[model samples]
Target: MQRRDFAAALTAALAAPAVLGATPAHADERSGGGLSRRMRAALAAELDDQDTARTVVPYLQDIGFDWHPETIAPERLDFIVAYGFGNRPPAGGGDPAKVLPEPGPVNEELADTVARIRRRRTVPVYAQWEIARFLESKYRMKNVTSIEPVIAPDGTITYLSTDGVAAQVAEARKHVPGGIGTAGVVGFRDHVKRCVQTTRDRGMTAYAPRGFEMPGTYDPESGQAWTRRRDLYVVHDMAAQWQVLRQKLIAQAYPNG
Candidate 1:
C-alpha cells in the first residue's frame, strides 16, 4: 500500500482512542475462550525464557519498578494480556486470518506499573502525530518547561529532553541553531507506556508486533489494514503461540458453564 494511503488510514484509526502508542483502531473481538492449564504451562515456559526476561526487565525499570534487576525473571511476570489487531500485513502473502486484533498478553506486573503512573484513564486526541510533528507542537506550546529546555541563539525554542538518555539529547541539540527541534522529545516513552497499559486495562489479550514507524495499507473494500510486517518481534510465532493458549482453553469447559 502507498505510504499516503496508510497515513490516511492511520489518521482515521487515530480518530478513535488509540490502542497502540502510535495510533488506535478498533480490534475484532477475541474468541470467547480462555487458556487451558497445560497451555498456560507452556506459555509460562515461553515467557520464562531469557530473552523474554531481558525484554521485560528494562520495561520494569522504565515503569519505575523497584525489583532487584538480577532477580527480575520473566517467570514472575504476568502474561494475562489484552487482545488487539496488529494492523499490519503478515509475511508471505498477507492473510486476513493471520492479522491479529490486539497486542499480545503483557506481563501483569507491567500493567500494574502503568496503573500507578497513570494520570488519567485516557489520553489526548492528537497524541498520535509523527514524532517530529509532536515534538514541534510541544515546543511551540511551551508545555515542556519543567524538563531541560533547549533554546537557539536566536531565542527559538526547539525541543526538551529528560536528563536520562543524554546521547539522544545531544544529537537533537545539534540542530537547535536551525530553529528546528533537532531532537525528538523524551516524553513519548511515557506515551507508549501508557498506551500499553491502557490497552491491557481495556481487556485486550493479544497484539501483532509492528514497528511504530511502519505504516500499513488499508483497503476500504476489504475493510482491513495491511502492513508489510517483517518479523514477529512482539510475539514470535504468534499463531502458534495463540493456538497453544486457545487449545488449552478449548480443552477445559468453564467451571460454572
Candidate 2:
C-alpha cells in the first residue's frame, strides 16, 4: 500500500474497539481522574519535547485516543482521552531498565489488515512482514498472533492466520514488487541489533522479542542461494523502533512515501 494508505489503514485499526488493554473510545474525555491526568501530563510533555506531534497526532486520533495542546480548554475537547498507541516514545523519564513483553492474540482490526495484505496478489511478503513488525513497534504491543504465508502452485502467495482458511486472493497486485531477499533480512536484523545496542548504550534496558528470528540467505555446495530464517536480537523501544523504520524508508528511497 502507499504510505498514505498505510497510515490511514493503521489509523483505522488504532481506532478500533479497545484491544490489548487500550482505553475504550467511548470513555469520558473530561474525567480528570488519576490515570487520565497522568496520561494527559505525559502526552503534554511528549508534545512539548518533540517536533513529532504532527506525525503522531493523526496516529493518536486513529487509535481512538484523544489529544490536544494543553492550551485548549477541557470543555473544548471532544474528550481528554489518550491511548499510547504510536512509537513516539514517552516524554517523561520511565524505567530505562523496563523491557516490554511480547504481544498476544491478534485483534480483529490487525487481523483484517494482515489478511487484506496477505491475499493481495501484488503485496510482497517481505513488505507484509515489515508491516507486521511496524505494528508491533507502533503499539509496543504483546501477545499477538502471527500470519503464515503459503506459496501457491501458480507461484502466488496466500496469507493465512492460524484462526482460519485463506480469504479469496486479490486478482491484481496491490504493492510494489519485491520479496524478502537474504540481504534484506540480514540487513534488518543487523539494523535492529544496532538500535538495541544503542538503547542499551544510553542506559535503557531493551531486548529483542522472545523467539525473534529473520530470514537470511544460505548457500549450498550446488551454488544455489536459499533464504532461511535465523534467530536475531530485536530490542523493542518506541524511539529506537522508529529510527529503524526511518532508516528503512531512507534506504529504500521512500523518505516521503
Candidate 3:
C-alpha cells in the first residue's frame, strides 16, 4: 500500500466505532467509577466479543501473536530492522545539542538485541529516527541506517508509520546482494507480529527474535489489577489488528487509485 493510503486507512480505523467507543470508556472506568453496573457489563461484553473475533478470524489471529526464532542467527539475515516504541520528540523542543533522544524501554530492548546480533556477526541495522541516532551515537553501531521522518513545509515532523517503514525497507532491499535478503524485525513482543507482517507485505522475508518483549509482572495479591492490565493490552492490540485489516481492504479496493 502507498504510504498516504495506508495512513488514511489507519486513521479511519482509529476513528472507527469499535476503537473509539471502547478505549475511552475503559479509560474512564479506570480513572473513576462513572459507569454503572449495566454499562460496565456491556463494555466487558464488547471487549469479549472483540477478543473472540481476534481469535477466530484467520488474518486477525495471525497478527495478534509474537513470532520468535529459537536462537540468534545473524547469518540468516542480511540486515536487522528495529522498531521504536513511543520515542516522540519532546514537546516544544528543548536542547539543540540533544540530537540523539534517549531510548525508551522498547528501544532499549531493541538495542540490546542488536548488540547481541552484532557480537555474533556484523550486520546492518535500520531503525526509526530517534532510535537510529541512539544506536549510532550510544551503541556505536558502525552500519546503522535511520528511517527518517517526513517534515512538512510548515515544519511538522511526521514519523514514518509501520507501512512507511516497510516501504522504506523494500526500497533499501534493492541494494542488497542479489536484490533481496532476510530481515529480522526487532520490537516489543506484541508488536513484532505486525512489523513482520508489514515487512513481508512489501515482499521481503522478515522474522522476530524470541526475546525483547515488553516485560510484564504478575502479582497474585492483586490479580484483578493484573487481569485488567492484560485485557487492556489485548484490546489495544486488537485495535491495531483492525487497522491492518483495513489497510489490506483499502489496497484491494483501490489497486489502481
Candidate 4:
C-alpha cells in the first residue's frame, strides 16, 4: 500500500457514517443483554411482539433505554429485559417490572374504587388517567404534577413544574428560550438557569433539564412522543426521588402491557 493510497483510503473511511447510536443495526459490536447496558443504551427486543410495542417504548425510556422504533414481523416479538436498577437506588434498577405493584388480588372495595375513577378522571388522555389512578391508589403517590404548558401569543408563558427536580426547568428553558417554545432559540445551559430563577420568582423551585436540546421521537407502540434523551445531574432528595418512583409505579410498571 503506497502512502498516498493509504491517505485517500483513510479519508474515504472518515467520510463513512460513524455507526449511529446503539441500534440493533450495530448490536453485533457488543455481547450480553445486561441491565447496565440497557439503562445506558436503547436496545431492540429479541423474541418480541408488535403488540408489546404499545407499552415498551415508555417502559424502556423510563428505565433509561434511548431507542428508535423498529417494525418487524409479529412473531418475532418475544424479548428479554435486563433490569436497569443499581445498588441503593431500587432493587429492580430503573424499571418497575422488577419493583411495581403486582396484580395480586385487589380488594373488593378497591376494585369498586377503580371503576369510579374510570368514569370521572381529569387527565389529558385516557391512558394517562388510568395509570395515574393506579399509582395513587396502590403507591401512596404525593406531590406529583405535570409541567405541560402553552406560551400565549402575547409572549407570556404558562409554567409547569411539580416535582421541582431543578434540572427539568433548566432543560425546559433550553427547549424554548425566554420560556418560549417558538422557532427562535438554540437551547443552551445558560438559558436554563434563567428558567429556574423565573420559576423561583413564581413561588416554585424547578425541574432540571435532561433532554432540552433534542428533538422528539415517536414510539410506535403507545403512540406517544418521547424526547431523544441526554444526561443531567439530578438531586437524590425526597421531592425528586420519591416522585420518580411514584411515576414508575404507574407508567413503567406494566409499561409494555
Cα lDDT of all candidates, in order?
Answer: 0.27, 0.30, 0.59, 0.29
Q: Rank the candidates by TM-score, best first.
A: 3, 2, 1, 4
lDDT of 2 by residue, 1-257 (tens): 34555455444444442443444332323233333333333444544633454445433442224311112212221111100111211235353233221211222233233333233322222222323454456643343222325665655544332111112111111121442111111112223344233333333233333222322222122111111122221222233445645665577886456
Looking at model 4, report the run of 10 residues with the lowest lDDT sum: 78-87
Candidate 3 RMSD to the correct structure: 13.1
Where is the poorest 10-residue window by lDDT in model 2?
A: 77-86
Residue 86 deviation, candidate 4, in Å?
Answer: 31
Instruction: Quote the lDDT for 129 in model 2.
Output: 34
Candidate 1 clashes: the total is 26
- The alpha-carbon lDDT assigned to residue 89 of candidate 4 equals 22
Backbone atom clashes (below 3 Å) for every candidate: 26, 14, 0, 24
Alpha-carbon error at 82 in model 3, in Å?
Answer: 0.8
Ranking by lDDT: 3, 2, 4, 1
lDDT of 4: 0.29
Off by over 4 Å in 1: 1-33, 41-139, 145-230, 235-257
Best by TM-score: 3
Candidate 3 weakest lDDT stretch, 10 residues: 218-227
Report the lDDT tens digits of candidate 1 across residue range 18-42.
3433211112112111112222233
